[model samples]
Every structure is written in structure tokens, then in C-alpha cells.
Target chain A: MGTVSTVLSPPALRTGMALAGAGFRRWATYRQAMLAGAFTNTVFGFLRTSVMLAVAAGAGGVAAGYRGPQLATYVWVGQGLLAVVQLWGWTELSDRVRTGDVQSDLLRPVHPVLSYLAADLGRAAFALCSRFVLPMVVGLIAFDLYLPHRPATYPLFLLSMLFATVVSFGVRYLVNLTAFWLLDIRGVIMAWLLCSNALTGMYFPIAFLPGWAQAVLWYATPFPSILQAPVDVVVERGTAGHQATVLAVQGCWAAVMLAAAVVVQRRAERRLVVQGG
Target chain B: MADRPTTAAAYRALLGAQLRAQTQYRFSFALDTAASALITLLDVVSVLVLFRVTPALAGFSFTDSLLIAGLANAAFQLCDMCVGNIDTMREYIRTGRFDAVLLRPLRVLPQLVFGDFSPRRIGRAAQALVVLVVALSLADVTWTPARTVLVVIAPLSGAVIFGAVFVAGSTTAFWFVESGEFANAFTYGGRDFTIYPVGIYPGWFRAVFAYSLGFAFVAYFPGLALLGRPDPLGTPGFLPWCSPLVAVLAATAAALVWRVGVRHYRSTGS
Candidate 1:
């Protein structure tokens, strides 16, 4: 076992790179599913854009500081980010735990959580190139989307996206760990997804929510860091300093959630040992 | 030497068995039901959030829009409860369960429908019903006996229309074993589309859903009739009353497609 640990103990960066690459390749093979996802995202993007535009029209061409073009950009970019962040329907870890396949995962030298995170990063990388770009291109053709002129916006948005991905993975990892306690984690996952989608600004801008609700979402949950911050950065909704602050908040949430996941996994591992898994 | 049960009896038997099996896991069933209800709540909240940003959408006041949304939600949930099993057709086909279904004594479609009856889904249906009731109270409709009857039957018509879409979507699984996601573009997408006033969409967009797909008859036209409001887009006077006929027609066409699909499956065995 000592020798095996030594053999498997590569630098964390190297392991993450390899896992991410594998994750990218694995999802790349599902060409049809990717195409279908892209199509659906674009269609929903159009629908959301239309609804937001109507809202703008009703508010005399601007609602909640969003013009027609800005709203379009917001909706389209939100669609692109949906696949990247992927706040729902991710049950791989729970399924493995339920089926006892996680035993093999535990045996590997790499920490299971890190490996899964790496793979998710890889999936997000692929999704950014394919799923993300597809909706953006469709939006560009179909609507006059807002484009950030500042060179800084692109790098900041990328940073925000990366942080959002980490935050999302952290939440999903913690949710999946519930499988250790519950035989069926589907209901828990579904409930988390419903709440996450609402709070993450996936359905609508979190700002549009009531002021008290917005305060609770911003201060009480890590949801906005998952989608709203990144989209805000891209749309240049605020000044550079405000964008920097959003990115920092996203980073903090990502770190906190990742730490929480590690603590939960430790507890879950102890539970598994006691339960004779 | 016992007499065979009628189709209705067979359906009830299958549904009862399914409900019994689900009820065996009472805790899990309750949890799932609550989760489904929460999802419906979030969906309605999303619509309400949009209304919060604006006083009206597409010439409809917040209350009127909520009524449309509530009706659409109730209709979609009812169809989802009945025909949502279509989502699993791909897996059945892949695992050869489709063959088992085919060999059942009952008609294949009814068997498929009954085999996947989920009592837990009523949670979302009940949530949508609350929304409908709230919308009815808020809106200034005449609430005549005939209008009330139309309102009651509207969701039933929606179920038939959406159930037909689900059937058509499931039929495609006979050819493409991984067609669930593709089918979602229609079943789920159509539901999302109808929850809002159709006038918000562009001309071509409205034309496809309203004319080609006949989605306008599902809620928008009926909503207009119930509210005693004229269609801003100038739909014919008879269009609103045509929802039931449209639903029946769509279901019939879907049944035909399903028959063809079953024949294809029998020949290919895939």
C-alpha cells in the first residue's frame, strides 16, 4: 500500500490535468447529447430573451436597469453559463456511493473529491467551448447582445466563470455526500436543485426578486456566485471595481464551499467505516 | 374460466399496484412529493419575479398573466402525472422491457400509462391548483356557469394535448433509443412556452406554436375567452372554443404515430 501511494502520488496539478482531460474526452463522445443540449439552450435563450424584452417594453424600454440589448445578452449569457455551471441533475457521485462503486474510488491514491472536481473542470472546459459558444453565437445572430468593450471584462469574466464552476462543484459534492446517510438521495438532490436554480439567477435575475429575498440570497447562500456574478461581469453591468468585488465574493464562496465539502467528506468517510461499507 | 377484466378495470388494477408499490416507501414518497411541490413553487416564483419587475406583460396585467401561468401550470402538471412515463420509454426499449410491455394482455399504450402511475406527482398538480384558484380569485372574470365549466375543462384539455405530445415524443424512442432529451424539447419546452401569454413571441415563433403545433389552443385562446378579452393578435372568434377539438385531434394523430412506431419496433426488435 505504501508503494502504491508513492507510485500514485503525483503533483496535484498533474493529476487534475489528467482527470480534466479525461472528463473532456468522455463527454465529447456524446456528440448527439451535446447537440441536443445546445439546441435546447438556444431555444430557451430565445424564450427568456423574449420575456425579458417584453418586461422592458412594459417598463417603457427599460426594466431594472436592463435595456433590450442588455437583457438579451443577459439571457443568452445565462444560458451559456447554465451548462458550464450545471447546478442540477448531477448524480454520478451519489450513484457510485449507492452502488458501492465508490469503494474503488476510495482505493485510488488521489482524493476522490479532487478527482471529481478535476473532471468537472474538464467538463466545464468542454462545455465552455461547445455548449457555451453555441448559445452565444445564436444570440448574436438573433438579437443585438451587449458586448463589453473593456479588455479587462473578458479576463474578469473568465475568472468569475472559473470560480462559479468551483462553487457549483462544491455544492454538488456536498449534496452527493448525503448518500452516505440516506439510501436514496434523489429527493434531497431535487430539492437542492430547485432552490439552487431559483437563487442562482438561472430562472431570472436575482435582483428581480424581492429586496428581502435578495438580501437573504446574497448573504445567506453561495448561489449568486454560481451564475449572476459571472454574467454581470460579462455584461459589464457594473464598474470594474464592482466586477472585482463580485469576483472576490465568488472566490470566497468557492473556497468556503470547497472547505465545507472536505469536512463533510471526512464525516461521511467515518460514517461509511462505521456502517461497514 | 374466469372472465377477463375490461380495459378500464385493467388500468385501475395496474395503477393500484403501482401506487401500492410506491406507498411501500412512504417516507421516500412523501419526500419526493414535497420536492416536486417545491419545484413547482420555484417555477411560479420565477414568473412572479418577472411580474415584479413590470406591471404588465404583453398587454396583460400581473393578475391576468398569473391566471394564464396558473392554468398552464395546472394543465402541464396533470399531463405530466399521466403521461410523464414517456420519459422512460428509451430505457424500456434499451432493456427489452418494451417487449414485456408489448406482450401484456392490455393494449400497449394503456399498459405503459398505467405501469408508471406516480401518485407523488399529484403534489405538483395540487400546487398548480392553488395557483389556479388564487388567479381565479384575483382576476375580474364574470365566472358564469358556462365560463366556470370551460375553466374546469381547460386543464383537462391541456392534459390531452400535452399527453399526446408525450406520446409522440415516446414513439420516437422506438427509432432512437436515446430520444428522451430530444423529446424534452417538445414536452417540456411546450409547457414552458405556454405558461406566458403567446403574444410576447415574434410572428414566426407564435405561428409555429399557435398554428403548426396548435399550442395556442391549449391555454392562450381559452384564457382569452375566459377573461372576456379579445386576442391582441386578432385570433378568430371560434379559435378559443376549438381547444378540445384540437386536443382530441392531436391525441389521435399521436396515437397513429405510436401505432406505426410499435409496428416498426416489432419488425426491428430494437
Candidate 2:
């Protein structure tokens, strides 16, 4: 009874710990890969800073709501936060579905969706540590990167990042699920990527957007709550409350996406007939 | 030159087979194309919206930025379609299917080129045309023979240069199998950096492009010609129309690296 009861507890938590362990194992083996990734990211961060500085140059005191040093701080914070948020690499579950490896996953007592999410969170967290953190530290040394002043910002920033990760993971999960229903998902994935890039402000700051665009972002997508909100908290330490509100918005969005994913996965599983020898 | 016609016919046959295989699920293909078109359209829209926020970006007006963006989109899509096979070559190499191409009668390059043709690239290309049209309408350029020639050659040469970059990147599979990820940075990441004018970058970044292999062809010189702006890099007048020259050089570079890669593949037998 004890063994079975322990097994029957929430699959997400049990699988989450197991998957996180697996992530750590993978990280150990792929240390070199992660280091290389960090180096590449640091190089790009420098390039991006140059572009922003060029744009903000010739202006008097403040350009795009940031002074020179503060703007540098924003870029460093954004890059560091990128690890905690973890945006790159999509189509994990979809590839499994396509290759028919998902058969074993479906047989588990834990829902395949939850299992996949747990596993992804594990892998992404490892990548974040090895890739994002290391690079940002190097960037801080080389570029005189600034950190947030107030102590309160750290806790709120962590909270915001966690919320952002959940929301982003949910979005990616749902996007991957579409491959189960659709025969060719590359185009759809590409299109989704384009939207996510705009919404998440991967290319630029959300503050750079126009009023109508900002309104559209708030209502139409959960993008602003992801990268932009977390970075906002870092740059403006006093705005932790606003960041918390954004985190709340992100939680709601996550719940909505998770619900949608469950429904879709159920429907797709019923129709899923993997035809092979 | 002797086998050009036959090679062309063979390429068409391969393309037809690939398209039909894709079209087997017609509804999915149609839906994907529509969705992709919408998504790409939104990306352009986002840029326009950003431009509306501020009258200028790094001293570039909305219309000028649109022109640069349109050209980049068109060039990238064309390259994507042509070398779509190379993008997946690492998988083929890992699975040992690359040997099958080596065993074929035709040249390895032609066989590779004909291997894959993603129809979705057309969606990207079409979206780029819409961007170009909008930019043209906004600009007050009097359409002349010279302008038409510049526009036509600009995207074509840009595609060639970009395709060469992919080929060079894909050839790196010969040296480091896992280097595919980093190879992507130079092509896709480089395209992003180049979409804006070279002048916007720092002196060091500009120096890399000036000295780097693929940068001049992809965006630097041709963009100057297309924009009709004085060469920010102090390039000569004739250098602006140096697209074809860049294309030839890139192709030569790709061919040489690919030849060396083929030798490596033979020796490893993997």
C-alpha cells in the first residue's frame, strides 16, 4: 500500500524530480557543448549591446527610457534572465510523436503531457545554468555589467522568471502538440516562432513598441509577461509590484494553455494511430 | 555544361516527387502555408508598429528600414528553398544516408540541390514580395530601367550569396558533426545582423563583415546599391553592384570546402 500510494502521488512532482536528475546527468556529459554555447551567447550579447548603444547615441541624457550605464545593465540583465526564462529550441514532443517514441510515454500512469513538461523543464534548467549564467557572468566582467540595486528585486525577479518559464513551456508544449494533428508542422512551427519573437520581445525591448502594438501584445498574446516583464523588474527595482502583476497574468495564461493542451492531447491520442511495421 | 539539360530534367523529377509526397496530405500543407503566411505577415507588421512608436530607428526612417527588411526576407527565402537539403544533411550524415548521394552518377552538388524543395519557402518569398511592394509604394522612386535592373539583380545575387553561406556551413559537417548548431549562428544569426545597415554596427562588428568571407555579399555592398546611399564603408561606386562578383566568389569558396569535405567523408567512411 505504501509503495503504490507513493507511486500514485502527483505525477508532475515525482516525474519533475526524476527528470531534473536526468537533466543534471545530461549536463554532466555535455559540459563542453554548454561551454561553447555560453561563449557564442556572450559574443552575440556584445554585438547586441553595440547595436543598442548606436541607436541610443547622440541623445542627451536618456534614450529609450534608459541612461547609458543603465541601458548596459538592462542588456546584461536581459541576457542573464534569458537563462532563467529559456526560449530557444522547440518541437521536442512533436519530434517524439513523429518518430513514434511517444508510444511508451502514453502508457505511463502520468499523463504524457505532464511527463514531457517535467522532462523539458529539467533539460531547460540545465541549459540555463550552463549557457545563460556563465555567459552573463563573463559579460559582467568584460562589460562592467550592472546589477539591480534594491534587494527586493531579486526575489520578485525570481518569481517573475519562474512564471515566465511556465507560460513559455506551456506555449511550446501546445505548439508541439499540433504536430500530432497536422501532417507537416514545420511551417506552423516557423509561423509560431515569428509570433513568439514579436510577443516575447526577443529582438528588442517591449518599451520600444508603439501604443497600439503594446495594447495588442497585452490582449492578444502572453508574450509581454514573459521576457519584458521580468527585465522591467530588473531595470526598475521599484517596479517589482508591477512585475508581480505580470507574473499573475503569466500564471493565468499558463493555466489556460495547460487546459488547452490537455484537451488537444486527449483528442489527438484518440485519433493517433502510428502506422508502422 | 554537357549534362546541364539532363540534370535540369532530373532535378524537376525529384522536385515533383517531393512535392507530391508533401501534397499527399493536402489539407495539412494548405493550412501550414496559410498559417506561415499569417505569421510572417505579423512579423512585418510588428516592425511597422515599432517604427510608428518612434519616427526613426538609429536614424533610419520607417520606409528605408522596410526596404532593407523586404530585401533580406526575399533573399533568405530563396536561399532556403535552394539549399533546404543541406540544412538537414547532418541527420543524413549521422544516419549514413549521405553515402547514397556519393554513390550516385550525377555531381554531388546537383544531387544535393535537387534533394529537397520546401514549398513553405514560397510562403516566405511571397510575404517578402508584399513587403517590397509596400516599401516601393512608400518611396518616391521614379521607376526607370536602371532601378528595375537594380531591384531584380539585388534579390537574386543576395540569394546566391546566402546560399553559399549555407553550403559553407553545411560543409562543416565534415569536420565536427555537432558543429551544426554553431554553423546555424553564422547563417541565420548573420542574416539578422545584416538586415540593418552595416553603418549601424560598431567599428569592430563592421570590420568583421569587411574582412569576413560571406558578409559583403549577403548585405553590405548590395544594400548600399539598393538604398542608393553612399557606401557607408567607403566602398567604390562599382562595388555597390558587386552582387554577382560576390556570388561567384562565394560559390567558389563553397565548392572548394565541399570538395575537401567529400574527401574527408571518403576517408572516414562514416
Per-candidate TM-scores read: 0.93, 0.86
Give candidate 2's chain B TM-score.
0.86
Cα lDDT tens digits, model 2, B112-178, are 7777776777767877777777876875555667768878887787788788888888877677655
lDDT, candidates in the order shown? 0.83, 0.69
Model 1, chain B only, scores a TM-score of 0.91
Error of 2 at A252 (Å): 2.5
Worst ten-residue run, lDDT, model 2 chain B? B46-55
Which residue pairs in candidate 1 collide? Answer: none
Worst 10 residues of 1 chain A by lDDT: A1-10
Docking tier of model 2: it is acceptable
What's candidate 2's i-RMS value? 3.4
Which has the greatest lDDT?
1
Off by over 4 Å in 1: A1-10, A273-277, B1-3, B6-28, B266-270
- Taking the tens digit of each residue's C-alpha lDDT, what string does model 1 give over A118-211? 9999999999999999989999998988899899898888989999999999999998998888757756777787777778988888878778
DockQ, all models: 0.61, 0.32
